[model samples]
Target: MYARPAHFYARILEAPLHFARIPDKAAISHAGRLQREKKTKELKGESDSTSKAKPWVDQDLQDDTEIPSPNQGDDEEDDPGSELDLPHVPYAPPRYAVDSMLERSRDFYTLLNQRRSVRFISPEPVPREVIDNVIRTAGTAPSGAHTEPWTFVVVSDPDTKHAIRTIVEEEEEVNYRQRMGNKWVKDLAKIRTTWVKEYLDVAPYLLLIFKQTYGIGTGGKRKTHYYNEISVSISCGMLLAALQNVGLVTVTSTPLNCGPRLRVILQRPTNEKLLMLLPIGYPSDDATVPDLKRKPLDDIMVHI
Candidate 1:
């Protein structure tokens, strides 16, 4: 075999590192094909992973239903008030000394502590003005995006109240026997509650609270009511407090799977869903309460 020339060896040394390792056309084509296949697999894997992942939260809590936004159309102008910056007003509440604050807090707690859910409500008429004021206080609760998506339907007519009772009883009977599991029924046994809700007819007023899932805007387009359920829940807390303050009594009742029927009977719009049905009045002379204690603050609260 002939030995390679010194110049040839020098040329090889001078060549680029990549040029020295240049593959044949077939080898290069095969590598390119493999790379394309790998990328396809990666993209497919990514799609599958996304499709298989669970939702971040429960479907009921997510309120995933979409509403057609009023400003979505090209011809429609965006609502100017929604985007306008509002001027802030100064807020100054009266301040109290430390001892006074402590005493006030204790007194408020004591007053609220006396409050109880009384199933036996008196049929004596409650002043309409008082109910109005209590509901107005509830409306002061904070809401997401300031939507204030709550409605208080106060029913006083005897026939309408009875109709509500009929609907509630029909659904609650099924809930007790089948919908609510055996464990739930057994647990409620201690409270001596059943499907029978006589207070619905006996009470003087039935306040059916509804949450507006969406609102109508200009041109009849639907606008989103963000976190409507949560907003209404906060308002209900204030309403309950107000009721307690006025020496009135009520039992917060949520009729299971009766929203549609109650909504129809009450002649409410389709956008609204029933959240709570409270029969409000004075407690009966024979009204008795279950002996229950609330959890301690330490048990319920966490401080970081």
Candidate 2:
């Protein structure tokens, strides 16, 4: 213990440096994946307790409900003021003298309440401009990551509608007979909807809304879209409002077996997934809907 070898002293000096090497995130993730596979294969024979202690390897952890993202451990609080270089603008708005805002809001709510899902649509022709304007209004909805991932396909051609109806009817027949259980059949009985979808032809126009899962970039690389379901749902709601604003009645549907079949019929691109089929036109003379009441505000809302 009087004097250590030069090699031993050098090793002692390098100990802290070894620990201080900046973690290569991509390299660590790849290595971690490989190690995880090795661990999986070894787990059948032996158990290891030091798996979590390795600082160089990122742990792939999951809970019963959800998988935790890798970025969960990132210290975002360290860069509290960090932001993208976006243009700044002064806040400006004209203050209203009267209570028109509140009055208009109440009136709008009342008007929307009167709107109904019309199943029987008259085969009356509507101006193409009306559909275009309504769709434009729907497009104004906010999207996730500014990715406007919605495509509306309007179907007015008689032959296409007939084909879609035929395919949907076939699928719906199978669903009602074998796929759907007794409870489901009983639940649907109140609505009086049958496998035969004659309304497909009766409706002057069919608006098929598709949600884009991933967008293809300039190099044909697929870019992930965030919150596509939420974004499209908001857009659909706005579409309904817009349609109602123009006195057009619509009934939205998620028709059984229609999605894949419709895609083939419509010749849609791979990135889009069918979301809703809205049969839109003037309501029939005896058009009807289920007389259901909406939930009270107290039941739906929680005041904190």
Report the C-alpha displacement of residue 231, candidate 2, in angstroms: 0.8
Clashing pairs in 1: none
Q: Identify the runs in model 1 with alpha carbons over 4 angstroms from their true place.
A: 1-84, 179-193
For model 2 the local lDDT of residue 89 reads: 47
What C-alpha lDDT does candidate 1 achieve relative to the native structure?
0.75
lDDT (10s digit) by residue, model 1, range 1-304 = 3454333332111212122123576467656766666677687775433333221221223443323444444433234234223444467899999999999999989988898888999999899999999999999998755667899999999999999989888887776667446564565564335777899999999999998976677766655455677779999999999999999999988788888888988888877888899999999999999999988989999999
Q: Please provide the root mean square deviation of candidate 1 (C-alpha atoms, Å).
A: 19.7
Clashes of each: 0, 0
- Measured with C-alpha atoms, the lDDT of residue 166 in candidate 1 is 90
CA lDDT of each candidate? Answer: 0.75, 0.70
